[model samples]
Target: MSHKPRGLRPDERELWQRVAEQSVPLHPERAHPVKQVIERLNKAPAKHRVQHFTMGQTARKIAPQHNLAPHITDHLMNNHVQMDRKAFGKLKRGKLGPEGKIDLHGMTLAQAHPRLLGFIQSAHGQGKRLVLVVTGKGKAGTGTGPIPERRGVLRHQVPHWLLSPPLGTIVMQVTPAHLKHGGDGAYYVYLRRRK
Candidate 1:
């Protein structure tokens, strides 16, 4: 068999070694795509990340502050404008059914607020005496974030809203719903009769 060069000559091998050492690698170690994205996000200031109000944030922000006057229905009675004990008892006992019903679940405060106001106004205009407003027992929101989570925001707000200016004029009384009418998740709104 003819003799062949089994290996590179010493001079050629030395030249190849120098070239290999001097040349850049074909592919430098790339940072993982996810890692790169995380790094870029981390470089941003914290203020920018929380710049705008989220839906929950807006809801919590606009939620009516709790008031004691509305709750003390018996103490400061508005006899002419408020529901009488007999009518309120009938409502609480589920003897009187709602003439109309409106569900405010899945709606943010901005949406619910207007919708609630409109419903009350329309119901009053139509001569509907009693109505049901269902504001669901909200989910237990996460409290770990920068904004503290508030539960049952609508449940609290509906009563307060019903007792506020425009709505207060039309709404005669607001009572928690009976078990048959959604219990704690709803309110029995008694509207004033249009003369």
Candidate 2:
């Protein structure tokens, strides 16, 4: 049940009236903060306005076709891998233990890129065939911001780096790690036997 507000006593009402009569408005001429802010914003010319693009439009602009042959390029144009039936079987079966492994967590692009190249080169030098590269499935971005945040930059970029020259020539194949290994956040890098 809703309760009504109690009526003020006669003495209380008189006291309230006296106080109200004595009290003058403080800063009655003051402009509202929100209004002032709106006025300032109206006066300023906005430099950057939001631009919307469809998926196809964005893909056309951001993703250009590569001149490289399909065989040399990974499915994502990131890494190159050619695996025969037996090699594919071995990798998928998780029969081969990673001779080397590198975790690329909490590292920025600048730090991760060079370290990745170095790790791969070193593993290749050691004649290691199967190695693991871990890139955590990045956190989902907060959707409120103007610019969209991309998740799993390394997950996408690592494949590209693996397919690029110098390392590409050495990297024989790359496959997504099995669930036992690291699932989506990791890769199984199979290197060519040292010549």
Candidate 3:
């Protein structure tokens, strides 16, 4: 059976009133802060009035803020050329054929690192000048998180790997591959002459 609502007993009601009267509010201002804010907002003069427009008028557009880092291609392009200018131009134009090539498309970071290091070392030891590293354009991520995820993991990391220890000393220039070689997915790695 459902219980019916009942009024507080006279003794209980008196006890409640006594307790309430004796107790102090921890945050008196917070009790009605929302109401205070509304009142203040109502009293303040309006700073930004809405503009009137006709039915067919286009809405004003705001320029988007660019918070993300620059593209990997831009970074590589901006880096000072370490090799010959004439050869660099030829390399960029796909004139210089890669003597050695490595495909690290589907490999994890752990797997790709050691393989990349060894490949570069071997290529340098064999007296290869230009090499091709194929790291396919990574899959798109769900743009749900606060910090945006970079598209290609290998594409971004490959440049850094070439520039860091062991490989950095031997590697002369690193550039994005031309369309025929593999657009943004591959790199043209030029190695220094063996000493």
Candidate 4:
């Protein structure tokens, strides 16, 4: 290999060094608007719809299990860019207390299965519209991040279990509750009212 001018001659390097150090400082006036930055990032995901199921599709395709009164269900089924903050806020404030609570902690799927089903039926029979099943934030079962259910075991399986035929009419839809109600750590399980 040819010897590239050994590094640059001192004067050549000095000129480059001076040029490198001279960065036109960011002018506050030229800074990008927050809206512009948000718009650009929002556009990126529109192209990658596979990864993000739009928190943006309000139609039937997005929320098949959405079943409440017509007006109420429509409000809940909103998949706008942001969850309907107002509706979520109201639900959070509203104390639709669970008829009973089940600690699914350390319980294997086989054990929790029947228990969960029975719990739903009892709640439904008792006219319990809301049931709080303590999946324990799904954290104890796996040592993953905050969304503990993403790991093997409970996280991957619970939704399927709930959606199957027996539990199908039992649970309406599961959604992350407001911060006061445990937020993502726990789900607000809306049970179907016994007619």
Task: Give the worst 10-residue stretch by lDDT in candidate 4.
Answer: 63-72
**lDDT by residue (tens digit), candidate 4, 27-137:** 846757887898888877555345556775765564222223333223334634232455445556645555566667677889988988888788788887666655544
Q: Per-residue lDDT tens digits of candidate 3, residues 1-195?
A: 999989899999999999999999998867587898999999999899779978847877764444378899999999999999999999999998999999998999999999999999999999999999999999977756777678889999999999999899999999999999998999999999999
Candidate 3 accuracy as TM-score: 0.67
Relative to the true structure, candidate 2 reaches a TM of: 0.57
Worst 10 residues of 2 by lDDT: 64-73
The better candidate by TM-score, 2 or 4, is 2
- Candidate 3: stretches off by over 4 Å: 1-67
lDDT string, candidate 1, 43-83, tens digits:
97776354666567545455433343443233223344367
Best candidate (score: lDDT): 3
Ranking of models by lDDT = 3, 1, 2, 4
- Per-model TM values vs. the true structure: 0.57, 0.57, 0.67, 0.45
In the range 31-60, model 2's lDDT, one tens digit per residue, is 889999999999998889779866676454
Clashing pairs in 4: none
The deviation in Å at residue 159 for candidate 2 is 0.8
Pairs of colliding residues, candidate 2: 78-159, 78-160, 79-159
Predictions in order: lDDT: 0.80, 0.80, 0.93, 0.60
State how far residue 78 of model 3 sits from its true place (Å): 0.6
